[model samples]
Target: MLTLKGKSVFAGITIGPLALFHRNTISTASHTVENPEVEVIRFQKARDESIEQLKGLYDKAVQKVGEEQAAVFEVHQMMLEDDDYVDSVEEKIRNGKINAEAAVDQTAQELADMFRHMEDAYMQARAADVLDISRRVEQQLCGGAGIDFSKYDHVIIAADDLAPSETLQLDTDRILGFVTSSGSTNSHTAILARTLGIAAVVNTGNQLHNDVDGLMAIIDGLTGMVYIDPDEDTLSQMRIKQQEEKACKARLEQVRHVPTVTRDGRVIKLFANIGNPGNLPQVLANDAEGIGLFRSEFLYLENSDYPTEEQQFEAYKKTLEVLEGKTAVIRTLDIGADKQVDYFDLAPEVNPAMGMRAIRICLTRPDLFKTQLRALCRASAFGKLAIMFPMIISVAEVRKAKKILEEVQIELDEKAIAYDKDMEVGIMVETPASAVMSDELAKEVDFFSIGSNDLTQYTLAIDRQQTALDAFFDSHHPAVLRLIQQTIENGHKAGIWVGICGELGADLTLTETFLRMGVDELSVSPPAVLPLREKIRSLDLNKA
Candidate 1:
């Protein structure tokens, strides 16, 4: 029997039949064809059939899950309708003069190659989606049906990777867990698994499939561990532990509506981090105090150019209307080397993370910065709106950004546009330099929100994106803890509130540590708010 172990982020254990996802190998023709028009036609027909199948899948998802939960598929639907993507395929078919199937295959390969060349990991991941859709099309053209796993009683899905659509087809009653060769905790597969309450492990290495089929194996999702041919004693213990864990989670939900105050009567505000305006419903459902981070980069990415003031106003207003009376801390555009905007005409830098990004970008492009400020200020008149800047390294940049904001406010006044002049402004302390200079920056900004994810990466000089160095990027390192403590102290000394808007704030294990460090607010994923509130309510602040 073989054993594999990794850090456990979520907890659960299950034993089931293994269903592995192996990569499909494409066999291309050896001879080069002069005219491939016939292949292109065939490819187009296949692509159309795949689109229809995807539509059917969408309908099934809506029927199984509520429309709101299934709304994630809308982007996939749009991809099919995208003019540029369709044109690219047509151009290849006409120019290359290849067979329809060959043309489709070649075009798909080109699209994937283009995305892979981009610097952003998020964009690079999109290549997988493109390849997945093309493969589905190819299968349909060849009259190939997906593998049937309906007979399995309890099964575990093992795959090179699972796309959102592929995951939705899972037989929940029979599928108990998932193991993938490549994926991340933040990927769509992981998100779907969490929502479905299924156990999953990614990046398990290639050797796992040696004896996977028909093997009686046990998997612990929380720890990302797999045990082959577990002894009866181990299985029995796992079952008992699983039941106890479920009971604990159920108990945690009982305090969903409770206040987050320590045993000694210290209040700690908890909010939710939102990626887009569409997520407002979930945030409201969790009874979040307000939004901690409203990432505005999505608007920039969806469009070819910068979003107009009216468009920005509409998005901001919708969030404020939904959260009415509560605070909504809206973060400005954070595009940089990692996130590219085609309209921005940005030059590629060797070290994007260290290059011009966040507040730095805004400083360089004040006109774009002013437009966002105007929209935000106008939206603030309707509700509590707080402006938060990202990737701030020094006080000088904060002061300069504030000057532009003031100029925007003056322009609004000249135009007789009503706005809130008293709206508070804050900075994201994600860099070691910012953390060390918190005492200076605290005096300039109204508040501070520690971005522990980036802060830890910078402090330890480790690239979190590089899997080989993930071990050294520990958030609990003494250096990270000290920085958090000092930042909180500096903010309090300057008579301003300090909060955390990073992944660490939502972590169950570090809840006590943050409370002890005197963090005033904790912003996390919406699903975690209630549990965190309950933890805060149970804590004895004075004891800490």
Candidate 2:
């Protein structure tokens, strides 16, 4: 029995058979197989075979996992049909006169390289799909030579990396957990696994590969820890713990319909964090008090340029109609370094996270900013609407932004455009600078919403994206906690409400801490609302 240890990032544990996701290496010689016509035929055949295999995988996923889970394959299907991708491969074959394998490999590398160079982590992750597709094509050309885990009953996948499409194809019931050599929590594979409630640990180094196969392992999804060949006592304890967790979760769900009031009768609002209109049904189902962070970036991304005033208005109005009287805090376009819009002529910046993003872009491009504000104001007439500014660093930025908003309001009034003049305006306290100056900022703004993700990042000067920096990026760090406390104090001092819209707001461990810190509201993922609400209802605020 070998003992291997890793940091436990996520908390639940499961023991099962181990499934390994081995890496594929394709070697093609450009100098060999000089016949261009024959090579082209070979490439076509390989591509066709790979398409069939992907379709087979898709069908299996639908049959076993259901359509919603298998929907990730749609991107793969789109890639196969992409005329640009196909043309590029064909052009390479024709010009280089290389073997079909060489041409396909070259094309795949080019696509992967392009995606890898993209600033957005999400987009950069898409490069894995290109490589995955290329590998499938190579396997087909080689008569499908790869490890077959179809016989494994319960397995934990060990891989250097797994693409979203590939990860979705696993028979999750048979597959217990996954340990990857490299991946971030934000990677699609990790995100999908979390959505499916599968246990996963990424960036566990290469040691996981050695003991992964045939190892009776206990994986903690929340903590990202893998207990290899656990002793009988540990295994029994883990089983008991798992059952208790399930019961606790079920109990938490029972309070879904309950109001969030502390023992002393102080009410705390629990709202949902939403990215798009698709999340509205779930938000309603979870009985969220309101929409806290309606990230409007999704709508902006699906289009080329800035969405028209009418287009933006319609989207916001639809969301408002769903929530009706409940307050929907619509955050203005937060696009910048991490997210890119094709239509916007944004210059590439060295450090986009700290560069012109969020309100910075809005302040610089007043015309674009006004269009969004106009749409938001128009939508405010249908339901309760609050405007939220993201990445606010200084009081002057807030003053300037509000001034522009006032100008927009005056224009709307002159044109007799229906709007809500009394709409509450808020700023996201995401920077350490903003958090420290919260008292002054609270005086200027109606409310404060601590974006803990960015706040922690900025306060500690730790890049959350770098796994090595994870130690310093903790939300529970003393400095981070102090900043949050100060922000809350400032808001209360100015008689303004404050809330948290980051992942910390949803964390079970820190939920009580946040409540004690006098957070007026907690905005989290739609699914987390009920349990968090229950936690709030169970708290004794008077004692605190």
Candidate 3:
């Protein structure tokens, strides 16, 4: 029996036959082609085919996982369509007179190397993604088959390191779990595993080998242990533990429809944050009372250029229709800083976190902002829809945003389009300035949603994305709590509702504290809703 240890990305016990995944070898020999133009055409055809394949994967992933994680496929498609990447491959093909496969391999290697040398860890991690996409194109050029695991049933997939695309393409039903020889906790594959609720252990080094394929294996995700051909005693113990864990999850599922009420009979709204309509299934499955943070950036991020008004309208309409009258607070286009889109042509900033992001971008570019407002307004007629602006610092920003929204409403009215005239408007109190001035800001909108993540970051002067500053990035710091409390109190004074729609909202340790502070709602990831509901049910807020 062989034993391996690694970090667990998700906790579950899965026992199955081990299945080794191997990519098809693509020949990238530097053979000179008779015609460079023909090679370029071949590359284009292969690139197009690869993109089509990614689209199918994206749709499948949406059904298996949620849209947020499925978005990796969309990003892969974007990477393939990137002009620089395409131009580099074509240039290499023409200059070197090499075959399409050779050109793509060379370009991908150069780009991956550049990405590996990037300063940001996230950027460096993308080197794997570049290689993954390039491999797909190469496979197509060489007429080679892609990785296929459908023949295996109930198997633990063991790979050197599964890329996001490779992980998503697998038939998830056949996958009992995943054990990788190498991967980080922050890798997209890890994120997808967690999203899919699959048992996963990564970074096991070179311990896993192809020789063990089809061997009986047990993955103890809770302990990050993998046992191959385990003794009867170990297998029996794991089987019992697996049943117990399953029971625990079933118990959590029992609270799916329970109201989030404190012992003292105080009720709080529990909603889910979503990026697109594709996440609706998770939101419904988790029994979210509403959609709190309907991020509109996905529409822009998934597309090559600005998404048309019609495209935006359809997406919002579908989400609202899916909710069947449940409230959906849709935030306007918030693309800058960490969520940058190249088409925006935003000038580089020294301090992008504090620079043109969220409301700042919308306010500065009303034409771009108006298209989204029109879509939201139009979709409001489908169901209960609310518009919320992010990164608001003052009442002036809110008023300016509202002014553009009002103009969109007027335009819709002139066009004889229907909309909800009483649709609620709100702002995200994600900055220290906004939280401090919440009393005045709340008066301009129907409600306030405190974005605890950004509020904590700006208040502490710490970059939330900087992992090195994690020890100092305290979301529960007294100052952040004070700001949240002050924001809630000020919103109440203005006769407006206040909610938390950030990572801190899902922190169960702070659930009672938030309830005591008179928070009206808590919006978090879909998976957190039932657990938060259970926590709320157990709390007697009156004791405070």
Candidate 4:
């Protein structure tokens, strides 16, 4: 029983034969070439071919995932055609008298290293894109056919790292799970894995071996374990687990259109956390009751400048329109630390995760905050809309944020722009301080939506994104649960609804416990909605 552990990006169980996915990296040993022009032609031909490949992959990915994600392929194609990339490769080939393959490899590494050195997390992620597209080009030059995934259905794939393009090109139906020795939970590969609903254990730190290829394996993404050639008893137990998973999924499908009400007639709202308007299709498909956390950070991440009110309003209004009459809690600008814009030009921090961010940025820059508030207020008239402030730790922060929101309302009213006058305002109870002082903060806000991801990180002093500390980052720790329960009680006492829109909310193990604790809502990723509802509907909370 050779067991490997990793960080789980998506939760599920899969028992399958192991398949090793290896990308053929072209060696860059400089071999003298006869004709430099011929080498340039080879590089250009390969580049064009890679672009065509991306276009085809984009079309297929659109069907498999969604438009926003599929657009990444287009971005890859553009990067390939970029002068920076093309000129660098051409210069290496012509000036250095190197072969096309060697020049491409050298240039790619240079650009990739540059991106990796960037302070911005988004730019750092782009480094993966550079390496990914370069690999595709290198594959084109080497005449290497991509991994034929069609041949290996129902297999757990182990790889050093999978580029987003490689993942999108895969026959996902054949892929039961993924175990990558190198990958962050925040990578595009992780996003695709979650979108495709595949169990993945990433950042295993190169512990996976080629010898394990074709060996039967159990990928327990929930626990982030990879079991290779388990004992008979363990295999038997895993098989039973696999059966239960399928049965649970089947049971969840029956309640697709049903309300998330406990057996004892307790009602709970189940909402989906969406990044942008493009996610609406999944939002409706998953039958999520509403959008609990409409992450507004994408506006800042996707743009090069501080987003204007008109730009922000269009995005907000589109989201509200899609939710139809359902509610959408738009968290205002959770930027800085992990999510930063170069335009913002925020200073470096010794500890960014706990530094100036989210509501902190908004409070200091009321100009930026008021713009988003005006947009949200205007969009509210289109559908049920709520404004949520992130990283709140006190009643003063909530009151201050609400004061700015009120100012925006007054400005809009004077300008004769129509909006929902009764739009609900809320604050994220993510910090230990906020959870502890929920009684006081609850009196200031219309509702309390606990951002358990940050709450867990803050309470346990764990960086939620750090794969190294996965073992210590316990979301279910009694300390965090006690805070959740207390916040719920406090919200109820103050006549405000309470919900959790974080990774912990999707945990089915705690669904019954949350219902028993009187949580009014469980907001999770769209994929988790139905399964969570199944758990909610099956629970006899009264009995518990």
lDDT order of candidates, top first: 3, 4, 2, 1
Ranking by TM-score: 1, 3, 4, 2
Q: What is the per-residue lDDT of model 4 for residues 357-469, given as tens digits with 9 covering 90 to 100?
A: 99999999998888889888888889999989999988888889888888988888799999998888899999999999999998898999999989999999999879899
For residues 152-257, write the lDDT of model 3, one tens digit per residue: 5789988888889777766677789989887777577887877777789998885566689899999999899999889899999999999998887888887877
Worst 10 residues of 1 by lDDT: 23-32
User: Candidate 2's residue-wise lDDT over 68-116, tens digit each?
Assistant: 4454465576676678877877778888777777777888899889977
> What is the Cα-based TM-score of model 4?
0.84
Query: With candidate 1 superimposed using the best TM-score fit, by how many Å does residue 274's alpha carbon deviate from the native?
Result: 3.1
TM-score of 3: 0.85
The lDDT of each candidate is 0.78, 0.79, 0.88, 0.86
Selected candidate, larger lDDT, 1 vs 2: 2
Task: Please give the RMSD to the true structure for each candidate, in Å.
Answer: 3.5, 4.5, 4.0, 3.7
Question: Best candidate per lDDT, number?
Answer: 3
Model 3 bad stretches (over 4 Å) = 1-11, 15-19, 33-87, 110-133, 146-153, 163-165, 181-197, 201-244
lDDT of 1 by residue, 97-199 (tens): 5444555567678888887777665666667667667677667656657745564457776677777777777777778877776655644455556656677
TM-scores, all candidates, are 0.86, 0.80, 0.85, 0.84
